[model samples]
Target: IDVGLQTKSNIGKQEAADRAVVNLETRYQIMNMVKDFVRNPANKNQMIPFDADSTSASASIKAYNELVAERIKLGSSAKDNNQALQALDTQIAAMHNNVVSGVENAMRAMRIQINQVNQMSANAGSAMSAIPTEEREARALYRQQGIQNTLYTFLLQKREENALVLAATTPKGKIVDHAYAQSHPIKPKPMMVLFLALVMGLLLPLLLLSVKKLLTTKFSTQDELAEIIQAPVIGEICHNRHKSQLVVKPGKTSSIVELFRLVRNNLQFLLTNDGDKVLLVTSSVSGEGKSFVSANLAASFALLDKKVALVGMDIRSPRLAEMLELQSLPGVTAYLAKPGMNLSDIVQSSAEVSGLDVFVAGAVPPNPSELLLSSRVNDFIDQLRAHYDMIVIDSAPIAMVSDTFSLAKFSDAVLFVTRANYTKRNLMNYLNTVMSRGQLKNVSVVVNDTNPNVSTGYGYGYGEE
Candidate 1:
């Protein structure tokens, strides 16, 4: 609104300035015409020059009076009307008439010039008067434009304010009443909460159990293994309760130990009559108890009065010495490192089983892969092959390292070990790769750490007694 008023005022000022310019132009034109008339050569003599001190009519009258005075003097002096006096009188009258005519002509010319100047001034005035009309029209136009601009600006400002108000003001719903808590407690309904929690407790596990059953890819039964690999599952070893690696004892009987005995019995059918059977026991990954299974299986075979050498081929992380509780040095790595070291010196006897000989991973070598791939390992296996009836090489996991693939060449059979809940279904891809590549001979899976209650088919009816 203020801007509108200011705009109207500015427009009015602009109109006034225009009217002033027009008036000034009109005055300028009048002055120019007056100057032209005054300077015109044709009207130069016609323009009368007036003097306050000297009047033309007065001067002429004074000359006529002087002539009459002279004539009177001459007449008084002469006896009769002489020719000189008449002539003088005639000359005086003619001169007076000429002076009057000249004065009249000069007055007439000045009047005409004055009239021309007046006409020019009138034209200038007329033109100047027209400026007022134009000024009114221009002012009206300016006022209209200003009004439009002001209205537009005002509307825009109002709209912006409305928008700001709309943006700033959040619409709150009508409140019926303010909320206040009751004197008594509303929550802590133990029975209701316990009911819902009980329902959730029951439903949640069932839902998760269904999902796990549907999504499980790991072998839960020996049938699943047989279907996938088309190989005989020599044994399903139950999870050991004891922390010791050698779960099998001489006269001790347990479900886990009996499972190893069952594995030893199943392994007899897979072996060839080729003197010493080299069995490479490995798994897809570590902690699946390949070393444990190898140690126990070697012990199981030893219990049957068969000579068995459990060689720790996992040179990267040698755990057999820890498992067997024997000296790890002067084992495989030591025998390989020193050229003159005897195999008998590095071979240690396990007190757990009489016929079971344990060769631990001597020391961790930087080049374990290269050491496993060397011909010396094959020669060492051959030396052990001549002595031991069964050579159980506890090699590194096939999925983890390439050391197992190299050791698989010296083995007549590969016992691929996998845990029940620990191994995932994706690990089958590694086994499939090993089988497809023929990296291991006669590869068969021994699903270790089997829960007998979960999978009753492979439980062999052994229980904790």
Candidate 2:
């Protein structure tokens, strides 16, 4: 019934120790004892010494009352100055004779020796009273113990029952276990735990791979990507059919390229603000198709006869340059460090994706954080905005790196990508906070890697064919 059948009332060792540190309260140890007793297998069904035989209850009560009445009457008569005291004496003599005979008969019947009931009652009462005092002393000792001591006691006596219900010393129901309850917990299933651990080890990367599929999220249907982003997607970019229709092999045709072209056309509609056309194609975390979306998006914009600059702002672990096979020569870091360097040297063209230009991050820098926030980088983006009709910047993994925030400032709006299964529920809140607290304008969620299976299709087409 508790977290692992933990009574939750156990005086934890720390709490016990804390008592020792200041006020001495055996409260902690006492709690441990009770918990141990309750959980003990040997005493599991033990009726805690409070159980009474209910079958003979009515007869017992009747007999007890009658006996008490007879005793009081005899005693009062014996003490009385009245002549009836003599008759009481006679009655007592008769009763004593009957008891002696009755006691001898029952001794044989029960195989037990008879003790004087009055004397036994007097002796037992003293012993029982002494027990309470002894108990009180033990509690006092516990109170002297420190919190750590209390915790130690609790830990040592886990699942071992101690006397807890002294006040609740009434007959309660017989509570039992289902025979298979591990007194020595078969729990934390070692194999299951190992299996779960292996699963956990693989979960993140698998999710990362899954999210890397669809880059820019513009649902073909209404709210197709709802599972990823709570924010209303700013706009839907229909599957563009531009140079995407252009045959990759002189005459070969494809619809996949057309799909990206549609995404690019929709992005065009979003860039109405004109001056700061720096588009941040970023996913919630890494592997959410942000790089692919950014690269293809820039290509799509360039195809419209618009001068487009695809800047790899992802200072930390830039993958866009690798994907396009562009020279990872001096790009953002190099050009930004030396503002006087020719932007043309860095502005290398993508060999395959036509009309799209890419600026590689060059070598991995020790200080990517400082590079994005550098004044030179800001001026470079400003300068690029003037030259290119649309400035599509591919930045670092949003969650992993702090670089995106600095680069994001240069952009007018941002498109956030989230992997359908990879993105956790909490990440949506994290993304929302990034935009809300940062006050970054035009932030939209693009759910990526939408699987055709498993997704609940909660408007996000999470698992659509």
What is the C-alpha lDDT profile of model 2 across 3-119, one tens digit per residue?
Answer: 432322232432333333332223323323433433466742232221111223223323333343454444443565655655544554454344334333433432221223223
- Please provide, for model 1 over 1-465, each residue's C-alpha lDDT reduced to its tens digit, 9 standing for 90 to 100: 575566455555555544444433333333333334334556322211221112554365446545655665566566456988878768775755644454454455455555555555444444344344776566557645654554455446645753543343333444699899999888988899999999999999999998986797777766666666645677688767787778887986778888788777777778856663888899888999999999988998888898889999999978999888898788898788777887888988888789988999988987887777777887798799888988898988877888888777788888989888788777776688768877666877888887767764334555554
Q: What is the C-alpha lDDT of each candidate?
A: 0.71, 0.56
Cα shift from native, residue 201, model 2 (Å)? 38
Tell me how candidate 1 scores on lDDT. Answer: 0.71
Q: TM-score each candidate.
A: 0.53, 0.46
Against the true structure, what is every candidate's RMSD? 34.9, 32.2
* Model 1 spans with C-alpha error above 4 angstroms: 1-214, 457-465
